[model samples]
Target: MVKKKPTNKDDNLVAQNRKARHDYRVLQTYEAGIALTGTEIKSVRASRVNLKDGFAQIRDGQATLMNVHISEYEQGNQFNHDPLRNRKLLLHKQEIKRLAKETDKKGVTIVPLKMYLKKGFAKVLIGVAEGKHEYDKRETMKKRDQEREISRVLKHY
Candidate 1:
């Protein structure tokens, strides 16, 4: 029998952490599997999730994403999962070890970059990031302003 094509509902991007890019220097990225409930998945599909203040922790050989909120489903009834529950993130043993070592560095953190569905399963793109210093943030702002100014001048000319 021929294999059927996968559907897009399970492959769409539900939400993203746009602030992550601006606040940290992303050093490495890893795709991780997230354990989600039916209601939570539905809520994610509706784009009712937030990862702005979310973070991942390595605990007892597992990665858990905390503070990530997925709103309760409209018709979920009493079985709806907690909006801010800590969700398990699936990663390989070796990957988790690497992440643990990296996070041991001062100011390094595991930040969720985006959440999407792949092959009918929810996946999170996690980043090994280091927080940007004040000077670094100021430099980034200066560069952004310069680019905006150049764009404005070109448009007027």
Candidate 2:
């Protein structure tokens, strides 16, 4: 039996960090290309990317993605990429400087939100975010609950 390959649109998304939305107030978003080894790319295409517990930082004038897990490819032997390796993110020089400056501000940080394929190349969606306070989190939950309740009532009517 021949295994079927996933279609372009269906296989675009590799992973997402849903918790980032709930825990941070997003200020801005940027798309960056990830540097991945051959085996890692295969693993990502197999839907083995994980964005939870991941963050980005600027070091030595470069942006690096840390703690994002890309599992080893099953068919790859000793050439498999490390699952926990810090990956480089490709960005323009000015963008990297800007991110570095912004992240230096109190309560601001860089976070990876999602990984997806664009034109067959892997790309990451990163956000400039501020950590949400406890009360702010509560307010977000309340708003969400109200929205849900309103939708339910409208559907019933």
Candidate 3:
């Protein structure tokens, strides 16, 4: 019997924005550390985060994550953080400059794809994306269905 070494890619995944892929064509991805308060970090560790309506923006030479919700910790009481506060994303100045330039293009934006814990710190995977048209989305769905059918048929052989 052979054992496979576990991959750490998603071992600590806290939240994911599945809709981001469907709505946008990702051009590039960057891993960034996120700033979180004590209660916010606790809530994130509990997997109480949402990336559905989240987006990232580069402002004043810094990257900020906006509209993401990290639910308040149940036991935080008076120290609980706001669920929808904008949080800073830790990225190098060069990366932030590049992202800012990329987003200057029409229809291109930065979005949070996933959040996970790395080395005891919270991290976010942000993507540079261009919005997909309706027809593009339909085509992608059709192609996915075709691939699924092909795999199913091959498995039966």
Candidate 2, position 50, lDDT: 89
Of the two candidates 1 and 2, the one with more favorable lDDT, higher being better, is 2
Output the lDDT of residue 3, model 2.
96
* Candidate whose lDDT is highest: 3
Q: How high is each candidate's TM-score?
A: 0.86, 0.90, 0.93
CA RMSD (A), model 3: 2.7
**What is the model-wide C-alpha lDDT for candidate 3?**
0.95
lDDT of 2 by residue, 1-157 (tens): 9997656533588898999999999999999999999999999888898899999999999999999999999999999888999999999999999999999999999999989998888999999999999999999999999999999999999
Residues 104-126 of candidate 3 have per-residue lDDT tens digits of: 99999999999999879999999
Worst lDDT run of 10 residues, candidate 1, spans 5-14
- lDDT score for residue 129 of model 1: 97
Candidates in order have lDDT scores of: 0.92, 0.93, 0.95
The Cα error of candidate 1 at residue 35, in Å, is: 0.5
Q: Which candidate ranks first by TM-score, i.e. highest?
A: 3
Cα error of candidate 1 at position 5, Å: 10
Q: Which stretches of candidate 2 lie over 4 Å from their true place?
A: 1-11, 155-157
